[model samples]
Target: MNILKKVILIDDDQINNFVCESIIKNERFAEEVQSFEWAENALDYLKNTAVQQPEAFPDLIFLDINMPGMDGWSFIEEYKQIPEEVTKNCCLFMLSSAVDRKDIISAKSLKEVKDFFSKPLSPEILSFIKEEFICS
Candidate 1:
């Protein structure tokens, strides 16, 4: 498998982040994994790293839709303001526990969001993602 350089998990649930990080590491899906409880913090990291060290920017991002401060939707809005060169290579996916059909439709409609998946990253899903998005 082609391991990604970095991946970011933006979700309020610490347990979910821990589980997802473990799964990513065990699967060797990414060399580095960073988890953020706040979407704003993740955005700040992206903004700073994208400008200072583009290579340090995450190759993939798993964003949750129901964060306390800034939800995934708001994060996408802010993300759009970042430079295209910095974000062009980065793949963003919505990883939320929300079962709302509208949420899925809304996420899929966004240009930035590559795909949507339910909470808790699994090895199977990661494999599919690696094959379909990263390796392709």
Candidate 2:
């Protein structure tokens, strides 16, 4: 079964968001792609919608590590507080340009974060995620 129906992109960088959104849409990886420049807004959206319509939650979330407000780390922390019904079925991936070893280790340690990827997510990575996480 195809598990990617809706996807949420939380990155403050517009260029990154544009590129990622373009790729996700062009490849038909997800039926819907919602890009947010602020992680806080994304969180609020999920918080409000997940309860009112649990199925409206995105199947996948691509989060950026650094932002002016509510960085990815902060987002993850806040994400944990959201209801389980909103987050239980979805996968979260850290998409960042930072290559710090400490950052990598930190991301891997988080149960909420499924994986980490360098900037400009590739189609191959998405395919693998779909096969390994979604299809299974």
Candidate 3:
């Protein structure tokens, strides 16, 4: 059985999105996985779903730190405007290629960010997340 109902991936890298989606599917971590190349699109999706289909809102969101427009930090700023009822159950994590200490520290500082992970999402990491956040 899947531990999560749905998961969202927001990253500018199509390859990363493909790889992460495959891992999440292969692990059977979630029933559904949706990916967005732009953070704005993802945010719009969340907003629309929250209003029109609350039950369809994602259970987990893996977001990238770096993007062409509306980077991860900026996305969070906008996400905060969303109602708590829409985001209260959603767990957000930073999945980025950035290895800078400042980036990690900054991500950790955010209350909305559940955790920070390096690029290339792995099955082991998915399992850990399932257990740590979803199952808990």
Candidate 4:
């Protein structure tokens, strides 16, 4: 139940990805965090293009709202293509800066989404996960 033992991030923004990668690496929140600049690549990896055995079954996902072609919404929609086993183990967090009430409501409503938080993921959140799940 170590929550952040593995993490996968799908964001097109280089800065966001870089910042998050730095934070996770520096804080040791996760054993590893595999980041993808393109959602399609992430999706393809999720489907079958990347890991042959899916060892990257991330316990958490930091998903962004806006991207080039495959936006967060599109990514979630296509996520259904993944077999239920993989999807079931993944807990998604809508880690975006979108403050729109509609977006918040939609994220809250989604069964896949564990929570929604604005940008700049913090170590406190990571610590909380570690305490809540990892050290349980």
Error of 1 at 9 (Å): 0.3
Each candidate's root-mean-square deviation in Å?
0.9, 1.4, 0.8, 2.6
- Candidate 1 off by > 4 Å: none
What do the candidate models score in CA lDDT, each in turn? 0.93, 0.89, 0.92, 0.80
List the candidate numbers ranked by lDDT, top first: 1, 3, 2, 4
Ranking of predictions according to TM-score? 1, 3, 2, 4
Write down the TM-score of every candidate. 0.97, 0.95, 0.97, 0.86
Give the clash total for candidate 3.
0
Q: List the candidate 3 regions with Cα displacement exceeding 4 Å.
A: none
Task: Please give me the total number of clashing residue pairs in predicted model 4.
Answer: 0
In model 1, the worst 10-residue window by lDDT is 1-10
Q: Please provide, for model 2 over 1-136, each residue's C-alpha lDDT reduced to its tens digit, 9 standing for 90 to 100.
A: 3347899999999998989988888778988899999999999998887778888888999999989889999999999998886788999999999899999999989999999989888888888897888877
**Deviation of model 2 at 85, angstroms:** 2.6
TM-score of 1: 0.97
Clashing pairs in 1: none
Question: Native-vs-model 2 lDDT?
Answer: 0.89
Global CA lDDT computed for model 3:
0.92
Per residue, candidate 4 scores C-alpha lDDT tens digits across 21-124 of 88888887777788998889888877882246665667788899888988999999888777777678777888888899899899879888877878888888
Candidates 3 and 4 compared: the better one by TM-score is 3
* Ten-residue stretch with the least lDDT total in model 3: 127-136
Clashes of each: 0, 0, 0, 0
Off by over 4 Å in 2: 1-3
